[model samples]
Target chain A: MGEAIVITSGKGGVGKTTTTANLGTALALAGKRVCLVDTDIGLRNLDVVMGLENRIIYDLVDVVQGRCTVQKALVKDKRFDDKLYLLPAAQTSDKTAVTPEQMKKLIHELKQDYDYILIDCPAGIEQGYRNAVAGADGAIVVTTPEVSAVRDADRIIGLLEKEENVRSPRLIINRIRGHMVKNGDMLDIDEIVMHLSIDLLGIIADDENVIKASNNGEPIVLDPNSKASIAYRNIARRILGESVPLQSLEEEQKGVFAKIKKFFGMR
Target chain B: MNRQKQQYVTIKGTKDGLTLHLDDTCSYHDLVMELEEKLSVNQTNEPDGPLVAVHLKVGNRYLTPEQEEEIRTLIRTKKNLVVESIDSNVITKEEALGWKRKTEIVSVSKIVRSGQILHVKGDLLLIGDVNPGGTVIAGGNIFILGALRGIAHAGYYGNKEAVIAASVMKPMQLRISDIMSRSPDYKSEERNEMECAYIDDNNQIVVDRLQLLTHLRPHLTRLERRL
Candidate 1:
């Protein structure tokens, strides 16, 4: 059976959904069959980010509640050509609609068919979070390079470590402003990793295009050249047992020569 | 002199109070008989005189609560004789075990993460870091061999004399018994060296170098020795 991994963060607005979408897309791009399960029942956004919102018919609640079969609830993403599927959460129901035991059984059923199952956990340590972590073989904790995000990540790691089923969670420091980190204005990836004291999978830089892609209903990993997209791909490769060195996060200021070079290439 | 030594009961009046001595080696039956007879002789000259307090000393003998109460009832018959205290040289096995637990040191090696609490009945020796929002409480003392970035309440069971020592002492809050010292009030020392906290003579928890623990509570290291 394939392994299931849960992506979780204790606090809200820390790029958990974004990380989940990008990692799911990246893993699928590597020719591995991947199923992305969204456990954020009421606050469902994974389908929209994956651009599969319109195709969702039977959701996670319907499958868990035995209203529909697991196959009927899965939404195929034509972009990956049968490699990627999105099991969207129900937008009408809350987290209590599903329990951890039911989720564990459902995930176990899905694990038989997929190469990798990535469960997108909710923002808090509530029923949704527990349900997402119930059957996972591993966990990934996402956070930004800020005090609040790091503190919340610490709390989530504390909870995840207590789980007997889930493996030790790794760290992903997202939204790293290169210039800000260079100027000591923000917490660096090293500082965040050292503070959290977990293995660093990869670090995603603060790219505004990440927001643009999410708003446009596209996973950032589709754009392979972008900083955040490449970071996601690296983390995905690391998860697949490949050792990839971290990309440098210090984007320096444009010097006068670069400005003159840009003048020469006038549009 | 030999017959006096053989007697199971002895009563005397010192300069202050009357002392009642019970022979421990004699049979329980004989001891009770001699005690009753000795006090019965004094019951005749009783109520007319003033109340005289007596101290009962039972050497190397364990007395059950019921047997002690029986002795107290027998003393009550002598209206003039009042029992002040009962002293024994031996304690129950349960009490001895409790004393052992109170002095035992528990060694733990794990990251005390946020919102997690590690508490023990006796002294705690943690070999891992305590992240912020975590707590470690001990009935005796807390000794952390790693960083302490959280709250530590030593002497949780009202042991005001308990102490907290850490390799990296940056605790957000420190409590020794009822007294507490929070950040800003406590010098937020990010010092790398080891530091220990204890209630000083001023009744305030003070953080100082770890070596001072030997001077502050010299008896802390006196009970057990390691080669």
Candidate 2:
């Protein structure tokens, strides 16, 4: 059976959804039959990010409540063809509408057909979080280098460690800026790993292309030239148990002039 | 008269004193009337008895000053009766004795998360880290095998000699009896040595290495004897 992994971060706006979209696409590019399930319920956005929002006639709630079959609710990504699928969350229903048992049953059904099931969990440690993690075999905790995000990530890691099925949830340090870390203005990957005490899965640098790709309803992993795309591919490889060395973020500096511009609050 | 109404005001004689148990659900008017009737019956039964102090036990109810005064006046009306003191019947004298005799240590092996409060009647021993925003309160001593990062209050019921011992003593607040000490801001270090905190001779909370705590062991032993 395929593994179900939950992508969660306890705090909001810390790149959980973005990480889910990119990682799902990266795994699909690697020729794995992947299913991206959005467990955010009322705040669903995964379908929009995958450019499958318009094609969604049935959703996760419809499948769970038996209004539609799991196969009917699964929306195949146009770009990935049949390789990647999106099970969009119900935008009108809240998290309470779905129970953890229902999510477990849904994930069990998806696991039979897909090689990888990635659950995009909603922010916060409530019912939505429980539903997302109910059937996952592993968890990927995403966090920014900021103190608040790291603190919440620590709590999430602590929770995942306590789960019966989750075995040592991996950490993803997102939104890293090499110049900020070099200037001692932001926490580096090493410092964050030391504080959180979790194995580092991968690090994605702060790239404007990520935002542009999201706005265009395209995952950055599809754009092979983007820095985030390469980083996401490395993460997917690492997840598949490949020993890939980390990319050197320090080597791609923006020069002294750029630093001076950044210092003066200019983009 | 209802048997339940009659049982509302129970009069019992003990070796130390006489106890008057007032029912928790009885109205104030009914309590006063029942108490007066009981006292009059006792007075007529023993006409030439000496004055006896009566302890009023109101079960889990706070008595107003006016109600207390009314009860005291009713007791004084009987020439051979006097108001000793007002106490709650929620916990009986035997129950208090049982608590004092309790030397059991409660042990917990899970991480105490935020917004969780663990209160133990006797000594408490925890085998996991107490996270921030959590609280650990004990009537006796507290011993943490892991990091004590949360608030720990030992000797919450006023046992001045109770101590708090932890492997890593970086708690937000350490309290012993009435004295409380906030943890000082310090750099994180591998604290291989355990520490013990207790109220010193100067009436201030002081933390010392576990090895040095032997000097205070005799005092703690004496306090246990008193208990």
Most accurate candidate by DockQ: 1
What tens-digit string does per-residue lDDT give for candidate 2 at B141-223?
Answer: 99998888789999989989899999988888999989999987885676778999988889999988987767886654454
Give the per-residue Cα lDDT of candidate 1 at B188. 52
Tens digits of per-residue lDDT for model 2, A6-66 = 9999999989999999999999999999999999999998988887789999999999999
Per-candidate TM vs. native? 0.88, 0.69
lDDT of 1 by residue, A1-267 (tens): 889999998999989899999999999999899999999999999999888899989999999989999999999999989999999999999999999999999999999999999999999998989999999999999999888888889999999998999888998888888888888889888767766789999898989999999999899899978988989999999999999999887674388887787689832
Alpha carbon lDDT of residue B137, candidate 1? 86
* Model 2 C-alpha lDDT versus the unseen true structure: 0.86
DockQ of 2: 0.08
lDDT of 1: 0.89
- DockQ of model 1, rounded to 2 decimals: 0.63
* lDDT of model 2, residue A201: 95
Decoy 2 TM-score against native: 0.69
TM-score of chain B of each: 0.77, 0.55
TM-score value, chain A, candidate 1: 0.95
